[model samples]
Target: MSLNDIDNVVEAFVKGARVASKSGFDGVQLHAAHGYLIAQFISPKSNERTDGYSSRPENALRLLKRIVSAIRSVVSKDFVVGIKINCADYTDDHDRHALVLDHFRTIAAWGEVDFIEVSGGDYEKPDFLATQTRSPRQALFSHFSRTAMDAIESLKQESTLSAPLPLILLTGGLRTPELLHTALAARHAHLLGIGRTSILCPDLPRLLKEMEKETREVGTASSEAYWSSPFRPEPDLTFSPIIRNLVPTIPLVGAGIGTAWYVVTFRRLAAPPTSKGMSFEPDYNLGPLGAVFWMWIWVDTRPTSGMKVCRRRLSPIGIVTAAFHARWPKSPLCKTLMEYERQILGLKLEAGSLGLKETLAGREVYTHVGWLALVSGAGISASTTYIGIVRSGLPALIHERVTSTPADWNAFLTMVRDININDIREGAAELRAASQRERLMEERIQAMEVQCGIRAAPRDLYY
Candidate 1:
């Protein structure tokens, strides 16, 4: 963003805080997790700016700090201000977890924040929030939260800040009350939060409270007997494997689907119940696929109250185009190419046709084919700025291998690690060429105008 844009954003945050405070909100938590704008600025890979908000560790947090300071200045001291931050990006980098903890220490030491919610991963790594697997990892982010809490304690002991140390709220894959109770008892976090669990069981807190009373009557440990309760209902955050495989192939799609699923579900829950005594219950009838379709329809047909007639007519197209910046994962041509490749190679992998082979050579060959299909057949516009390239068949390979045999699992790992550099470089070149070729057209037009001794004509000039 330009300096002006950054300033505007900070002003907007302060204004929002002011409004919230006046509107009787007790606190406002800055959502800096899950790769949102603040999170993006925090991430080293994403923030490439050089003017104050640069990727330099010290400067990277400039924007967030400015907003926090601005908000603090505007709001009353009694009003609380909290922040939700990622533990790590959940990439291959082992040091990133430690780095994020260090960042959190800086945030905590500022003495401006009231509470801290420790969450990890972004849309690309949605498994941290919720997973498609039958058994999701328990307390996915508790270790990070624990480490952060230790840092906060050390900061409190060394520093002379009068402001109370921030309370840590760890949230992720926390299904059962037992897990919540265990985390609090161990002091891993000051408070606990749930995601998928809350969606499935909105009355989970009440249910657990009543269960706690029952456990005390029997003289049984609440945590120990919590699992045996008949009321425990598994949260179904799973989408079809095919949808999962397809989404990751398209940029930002994995994130969009996760958000859209919740939005659609919440809308369903908010409506007055059709049957008696079904108020506030989850609408189990809406499956993942149904939710996504309904989300699309709802967004497409939403009331365009102050929009112009032309804009209203074109709004649906704009929505799809905005969501899928350049590449269309649902392109028939791309699907046809993948299907054709699968048929010709006599390979049929579940959840979208492509799979990993036991041999390194086969994997390399498949990767090359997958790259061409995605780049050429996806109809990626040349004018679009290239953000990142998708590792063509990896998502499908991983999805298929999820339930595969041990040998296949080992082969999947091998295929991932044993990539031929030449094949990858060639695939990258293909994607690069597609982007450059599109930009080249505009460049040529400017060159022609220069040669003709004329200024480039704006579209409005011709119109």
Candidate 2:
């Protein structure tokens, strides 16, 4: 991008904050982790530009520093603005780790940042999902959060800061109450970030508190802290036992099962919060396959759930099909597309019905459109919000397969220079770069673990 374009690049982030402030959001968290654009400018493995922002070690954070400054000026002084940053960039090189620390220290030392969330993982080196086991484990980035906090303290003393210490929020792999207390007790985390586990139990905080009370009342305090199972099976649902036995080892299918489990639960959750009619109890019997179908059916039949997805997706063909019995003569390709989808899914067209949805003896014909997005590379459509749920709701992952951007930076610059839509091209290209970096970082991390005579621990990203 040109020098003129670079100015807008920084301003755009500030503009986003400005818009968010106007939109009545109390705050905005600037994302600078996961090998994204802000991170690309910070990481040595990726940034090779000769510009002032990427030239020197101190200059590595120049762009984001400017963004933070611009945003602070644009938003209301008390408007909460935080940044989510990595503890490290995933390679085993200690020098790079030091550089990563330096970049984070710069951000933490700033008075403008209200809080800094510590998380580690770039697209190439992501360990996004921590272990799903019932056993307790430290959240993945606790050490880094501790280290970052310690460094920030040293910086405060060295610089003789007048501002208060920025808060630290740690994300990834937080589950049990014991684990929660441990991190806070260490003084590393000022706040906890509950990701997937919260989905399984919507009122997880309350559940943990109740479990703690029950254990203490029984004088079971001598034993390791044990929370009651977050999962519960329904009386009519016998599927949980079969699913538990069937596929506990498969992560992809397991992730799908876990995600599907939550989406099905969220349907009941969408019920009015004031009303006590809905229960949080989940059907353990519904495996990933069963869960996907349940989600599709719920969203389609229920207007509230369906509107978010169908508004963007339901094609011209589907509209005519839903409202009319005759074939849509104007759009034969639309008919052909649905026909192909049904054939691939092994389903006959429902007579006088546009959707694949049907019920025969309590069995529903469900199509996995979002899963097919990954498989057929068709991108996200149908139950797209649930797709957002399944794939970590980060925007890059949702519409990932749809965009085309050069993997290499030079090609990216060429496209950017030629287009007025620099932001779109830049975002797509940076996402590709992030993916490449993640793969490289993962390999490096494993090799380093082997050299140190330690097994690569599950969900442990920082070495």
* Best-matching candidate per TM-score: 1
Give one digit per residue, the lDDT tens place, for model 1 in 364-423: 222223333434534443222121123332334333423332345466456445555665
The C-alpha lDDT values of all candidates are 0.62, 0.58
TM-score, every prediction: 0.58, 0.56
lDDT of 2: 0.58
Clashing pairs in 1: none
TM-score of 2: 0.56
Question: Where does model 2 exceed 4 Å of error?
Answer: 133-140, 221-268, 271-276, 289-298, 303-463
- Give per-residue CA lDDT, model 2, range 1-463, as digits (tens): 5667769888678667766776579999988877888877777778888878773686878888888999898666889989887665643677766766776677777788888888766656445443443322234477777777787777766656767777888876566666677778988678778765666677776877777777777765543646433233221322467766875554455444455556666655644444466546555556557666765554234343312234322323443343322233343333444444434222111111122333323434323332233334334334431222222212353235323334575654554464345556665686677667655554444333323333332331210
Scanning candidate 2 in windows of ten residues, the lowest lDDT window is 345-354
What lDDT score is found at residue 6 in candidate 1?
Answer: 87
